[model samples]
Target: MGQPPINSTGEARTIPVIEARGVDHYYEGQGGWNHALSNLNLTIPHEEFLCIVGPSGCGKSTFLKIVMGLLKPMRGQVLLEGKPIEGPGTDRGVVFQEPALFAWRTVIENVEFGLQMQKVPKAEARRRAQEVLDVVGLGHVTDLYPYQLSGGMRARVAVARAWALRSANLLLMDEPFAAIDAINRMALQDYLVDTWMKDRRTVIYITHDIDEAVYLGDRILLMRPSPGRIGRFFEVNAPRPRDRSSAEFAELKGLITEEMHRFSSENTSIQEDAA
Candidate 1:
């Protein structure tokens, strides 16, 4: 769903949910400090589902961390709702590559974990957790423990857990379905989109899969490696429940794949030249 930039007064009021201004990060690597991100800048508007795709060493995860406030960049700043992000806070909820569900906890309990941590009343936490689980089609499985749930179910639980945090307006996902099989991955993607539609939130999803990015993102940000920077951004205007086999989908996927290949080829040439 496209969001209009205008407000009640009929004037423009489009403050971004997340903004990165001249962000730069470095890490100690094999040869002194390596540039992980360089002069990167981006802005994600309210309720925008933005997917970031690129090859390894492209600082996709690094950028996610900057947004997450897990690591501070060497230069520049990241802003959330127009304020600088100083550290991790409840305003942002995260899902990682692994579901990392608590084996000792049931599905409902797992989803309620974050709410409880925020000092929400037990009854309210359970209620919200159950509500979110139901939205993701996991209501029947709420009583089941993590170990009893299949990989796909576990993934759904992870998503529900993040979505259950009512105060968190931004959801940051880092390849949450990467470990699942192809069929299950697609199924989880559908579930995620359904949940997103039900309750819109600003989302930053990082993945290596081009098709996944195109399928889920309102806009796709492609990054280049060797001092990771913004390469390009693609707007997915095909509308949801996107047809994966359609010509439009295929064309967008092809364009992103071609750009990724170009980055890879350029990196290879640089390595050869260095040798």
Candidate 2:
């Protein structure tokens, strides 16, 4: 089945799954305060894929952390399911840029780690792990160690591990495909889309690549750095299994590119004026 169609209101039809209200984050250093995020407000609907794109040093990752409860915001609030986020929970799953697999553990074992922490029965966890491995096309390599697998294979294992935890409603991906080569990156992108269609899990993907954002997101959020805040938001109107080479895809990409260039230029001008 394809993704749910965008609604006439220009918002995803699903219910609000995650909500950030006036979220702000800051870190105090020796010299002064560093503002990572400021007055950020967004609502991610259930089972929708939202991608965040911005320039380097933008607080995209920081925003993800605030949502994940890894870092407490200095101001404002982040709510998951209407309750405040306190710390990490099994309800949310995260896929980092690195594979972060244990070298000694076999692929199946690595995927089973989360289940083990939950005290799930070994047999049940193993069964579920096998199923997820199959979903990611890693069934044949389940017994291999991380070192024995190719980079793409390793990334698949990471994805499988995350998906194996079926209870997770929110998936936070921080540039998960950035480290891979072009071929593997594209392949994994397709795999992600396929899996998302089947699972219908809510995803918050962070990336600097405009094409990746356009390809994956139901709505794309652009952020500005040096006091990170929302710059613009775009609803992707293209149909599923989007044709990257099509005129519509190119047009959207061009529009986002121009906005990014303007944002960068404005930031430069502001810095020069301050100096």
Candidate 3:
């Protein structure tokens, strides 16, 4: 599905719902410090659908972790709702590539996990869980366990769980649709777009799929691999429910592909020259 129109009047807008300023992350290992992210700056406006795309090993997952408060930046800051993030909270929900559902819990139980942790009343939690389950079209499977459902269904449950925690202004998704089959992935994409249209929640989606990024994102941020850094950012001007086969669609895809190839080849040349 296509994204909603963004207000272009350029008024003094409120602070971004999520902001990463000069984010530099590194992992101290036996070998040395592995720089995962390098001087990154990104801002996600409220209710905006932003996609981050990069080559493999470009620290896309690490970026998501930083945003979700699962990891801290060594030399930068991550702010959500204008507050510095120090730990995970119910205010931010994550849907990973794999559905990390508890094996023993039923669908409804899994959906209510966060609320239960926060000491929400059992009755209220269940009611909210049921409402979100219906939103994600998984109301009928509330009694079933994760193993009983197909991959797509499991993903739906995960989305439902995230939606149930409505306090979260940001949803961090790391290739949530990558594992599903093409048909089901497309269906879920439509479902997600519909839900976004209704609720206008801020979403930051990370993926390697260029078409998927272009199709779903209001703006696509592209990064390069070695010492991950932003390479380019593209604002998608295509109309809602974009047509993949449209002339403009193919043109933009081709252009982005060429840019990606150019970046990749340049990096390869640099490596070879260094060697």
> TM per model?
0.95, 0.93, 0.92
Runs of candidate 1 with Cα error greater than 4 angstroms are 1-12
lDDT of each: 0.91, 0.88, 0.85
Q: Give the best candidate by TM-score.
A: 1
Model 2 lDDT, residue 41, Cα: 92
**What order do candidates take by lDDT, descending?**
1, 2, 3
* Residue lDDT tens for model 2, 62-117: 99998888999888998897889999977888888898998989999999988888
Residues 174-218, candidate 1: write the lDDT tens digits.
Answer: 999999999989999999999998888889999999999999999
Q: Would you give me the overall lDDT of model 2?
A: 0.88
Candidate number with the higher lDDT (1 or 2): 1
